[model samples]
Target: MELNLKRQIGIFCVLLILPALCSAAFTKSRATFYSTSDGLGTPTGRCGYGDYGRTVHGGSVAGVSNLWRDGVGCGLCYQVRCTNPSLCNSNGAYLVVTDYGAGDRTDFIMSPAAFSSLGVNSTANDELRKLGTVDIEYQRISCSYPGQNIVIKIKESSTNPGYLSIVLFNVGGTCDVIAIQLSQSGSNTWVSLQRVDGAVFQISNPPSGTLRFRFQVNCGSGLEWRLPKNDIPANWRAGATYDTGIQF
Candidate 1:
């Protein structure tokens, strides 16, 4: 009876241990943010854990500002209001949140035609409009990075004060990097499927693609790690404020 009980107990242990190890091994899909200053990890949100479906877009085009603010084609889109009272004016418009925009400052893409619709074409108005740069304001992601040992840089993020963006990271070397639309490439309407932090992104290919890690952000902005890819200046320096590492 004692021997039989020991065998049964041993079987149970194997069942429990195997699944746990599997979870840990397979969990590499998630990203953990590590601090560059300290060796601590911050909490990266989970996948699909954010609202990319924000309702407001397009700041109301008016005055000389409207000449550049609402040029034309404004509907079912996004909005970028001026922080300065003298610039954006007192109204808002609806714009089609087109592809990736500027960067961490303004978080929307208002077509030039859209900016022209509001009337008033003055150089001062153009200057005022230029003050606001587009950025990613919403979305969430689990962060991870290679080395689980290196620290990542932190930055300010989010389009709205109430919500935060998303991000992910991974440890080790990266894989084949494919270039896509992180922002609007002139007249080209390239859309970004994901929001990224401006700090840096880390991807891992373990045992030669046996395992892949792509660190992502869940916030509303695109990441601009290098100057060459700084399509949107606003998205170049935004990210999660946490440390990353292996917990085990």
Candidate 2:
């Protein structure tokens, strides 16, 4: 009976540890860098983040091809490390996916800053850049931005009271925002917003009133719905940002 009890306890411990181990597992891939004079991401990248993409994560950003998932992969974070012991650091770079790109048989086309972060020092970094491409391993990681909540940005293309286009910003956590629905205040009917571009969602003929939003997110473990504490004003304007007052 004691032996059986010990076995059960051991199994329970393994179950607890397994998830952490799995989360840390890195998959092998190839990575290359894009040219930006300042080693930063492009404001005009495919994600539609604009100037925010240029400085997000302090410019440690990447463009992923296969992982794009029809724009769902935008804003996802990953920890990437190069395998070359002589030229690369083990800790690697932590980057946000802000664009879509594909390289010669590569999964990640990182920003110059992100690619250089894999090196141990300036000398190594220079050599790595000269190589132009390298073997890398990467794993998805949760994103966190200190002192920032989820922000909804009204795209400049939106037309008042008829069309609404918005983007999600500072979307932390390891979840993918799969869907968003907007409803008029105190109304049971919810209108689903469609993904029009990377990180951009839109709806036409939106209900005319104060609007509240709910997001459906999947964090690999499971799918969950998140509701924001704030509501969009009836007279929402283009080029404005609304703080959700919450994080994923």
In order, candidate lDDTs are: 0.26, 0.84
- Give the best candidate by TM-score: 2
- For model 2, residues 87-150, the per-residue Cα lDDT tens digits are 9997898888899998898889999988889999999999999999999998766676766788
Tens digits of per-residue lDDT for model 1, 157-225: 443223233332221111112222222334333333232422122222111111112223211235322
TM-score for each prediction?
A: 0.22, 0.90
Look at candidate 1 and tell me the lDDT of residue 130.
56
TM-score of 2: 0.90
The lDDT, on a scale of 0 to 1, for candidate 1 is 0.26
> Please, what's the RMSD in Å of model 1?
24.6
How high is the lDDT of residue 22 in model 1?
20
Q: What is the C-alpha RMSD of each candidate to the true structure, in Å?
A: 24.6, 8.1
